[model samples]
Target: MARSRWLPDQHGAWAMLTVPFLAGTFLAPHPGPAHAVLLAAWSAGYVALFHGQQWLRLRLRRASRRPAAARCHVRPGLVFAAVFLVLGIPLAVRHPWLLLAAAACGPFVAVNTLYARVNRERALPNGLAAVVPACGMLPVAGRLGGAGLPWAPAAACLLYFWGTVPYVKTMIRERRSAGYRRASAAYHAVAIVAATLLSPWLALPFAGYLARAVALPGRGVKVPVVGAVEIAGSAALLLTLLLVF
Candidate 1:
């Protein structure tokens, strides 16, 4: 495949990967080269796995229609994935548990890939799986940075994004349903309140989420604006984590 073909089109997933990695690295009490290498290796492996699985699914679907063309696409993607995997091996070797964490996260990726294959990548399962790899970052950074796993912060991040699932549904698939919009708003509002009760500062992002869920939908917020808002919200969440915990 050409270099462009190796790149993924899913910009949202990229943000999801980057934010947590940075959070884990920066929030770690003492970040060092090991943390950097671990994050790099993990990210490389993640991209390889994602693209490889995508190509496999594409090939399978197209095999009956155009087997030869499918093979051509699969071969290059697999080769690219293999090259990336090889690059990560040396780093993964020194920290075997990092590999274990990746293995654990692999099932979630597989689940996501399967959903994508069936054209259900926006389902509830995808929202849940989106957080798995990110959660794994907590332990990796913690172990390397001498922070010993920042569970509280990790939980906050998890719940914050998890809330996005329902809220986003209201903006897209469930957009016409007042009930779902209400439900999404209610969930976010509750989350904000709960997070605030737990830690006043931690609720800031959720509050922003709540505000958007209530104010944006039915107000003609397009998909691109929605994405921009999400990215901005994620940044706010990352900043909150960096300062609070």
Candidate 2:
């Protein structure tokens, strides 16, 4: 049977969500088997729930003859599930029941994403901005173990929220402005500033790009050059974080 075109693309969403969460998890503290299970369970359940709600909403919208935006919600869920099942199962089994708290938190935040999408009428990008922090926090909480909330996870969430704000605002602004080609540039600027406030080692090079972007008005600067420099600098910083920190 052909799949309905209106069905949500959870796999893609999962893939996108995994990147920052995995990156933060790698940088943050580690977790044991029990915590791992809870994280897996929570992540899995969230994905399932997201798809279920999206399906229900699509049906209702279709029945009302409202135009449906092409769905991308399910994509991330599928991707997250694939990664978690493949990697998380072994760890979960070893720890047995350590991840319950993280599991509990995942659905709470995920429902917020869905509610924002349905009630507030947020677009996919906005929904993602709301969802990503919760996803990122899952592994961090798992690593912390127990139900104890820590300052670092809160800090990480705050940093992510701030980083996403300009990006989201720029996305909205660009819809109305022709001269908004520098949206990514603006995002990099905000990211650099936030990173500086939180972690200078990660922030300085990002700030350098922001400076270049600010200085290079109407210079027709090569985008590839800027992108290459950013990528190289980010790689170097990651290497430093691994080796030195």
Candidate 3:
């Protein structure tokens, strides 16, 4: 009944979860009712995955943490999984081919679960694993809307979301590591170039992304500020993608 146990704890995941879907849905040429169903399915799947990962982490990592904590997730996990299947099956019946995206994301989901079970869910690998599938959703949703994979926009989406992983690491997990700082900066630089090549229009927002990646890491800015900046960056990317493509 408590809210904490009912909701996902990854505050920033809210944006990561939706932007790609919106990007893909909006970019799709033949957007329809199925896309809405897909969104609901996708959301249920994400919440299910989140709780499932947490349950595995608590259940397998140690006995000292208490089984009750793990069990609390079981109900929510099952409920969401059922919801995902309910919303997903009809779309699969209609499209049949969209399952490919779900299948493709499976390995990454496994990686995330593995890291969670090992209590390393916050590690860079786990973060990247999460980013890949989340970004991959762009193409899936685009194709769902009859966009035919929308490669250019999808690549742009991947570029933006991928950089966030290492950038966030530089802010939180690897804040003191100069190596991470360099890596994050380098990634943003590459993202900017890639976005530019994809479309000259995308370069500006990515440049803004690069500036924040470079300037804010060691500045002791609050987490909320970091989150706000990321939110803005995501919004800019989504808007720019919509406008350009």
Top candidate when judged by lDDT against the true structure: 3
For model 3, how does the per-residue alpha-carbon lDDT over 1-245 read when each residue is reduced to its tens digit? 78778779677787888898899989988888888888888989999988998898888865576879898999999999999999999888888887887899989999998899889988887887788888888888888777776789878888888898889888887889999999999999988888899999998999998898889988898888888888888899899989999
Clashing pairs in 3: none
List candidate 1 stretches off by more than 4 Å: 1-4, 66-76
Output the lDDT of residue 42, model 1.
64
Model 1 earns a TM-score of 0.86
Per residue, candidate 1 scores C-alpha lDDT tens digits across 97-144 of: 667776787788878888867757678878788777776676567766
**CA RMSD (A), model 1:** 2.5
**TM-score per candidate, in order?**
0.86, 0.50, 0.96
Q: lDDT of each prediction vs. the true structure?
A: 0.74, 0.48, 0.87
Model 2 lDDT on a 0 to 1 scale? 0.48
Looking at model 1, the pairs that clash are none
The residue-by-residue lDDT of candidate 2 on 1-245, one tens digit each, is 12443233433244334433444445556545544454565466556556555645665555356434324445654665676576566655665443564465565456564664464434435554555555455345434444344434344334444333333333343333434436646666666666566556756555654555444434444545534543454354435334333
Distance from true location, Cα of 68 in model 1, Å:
7.0
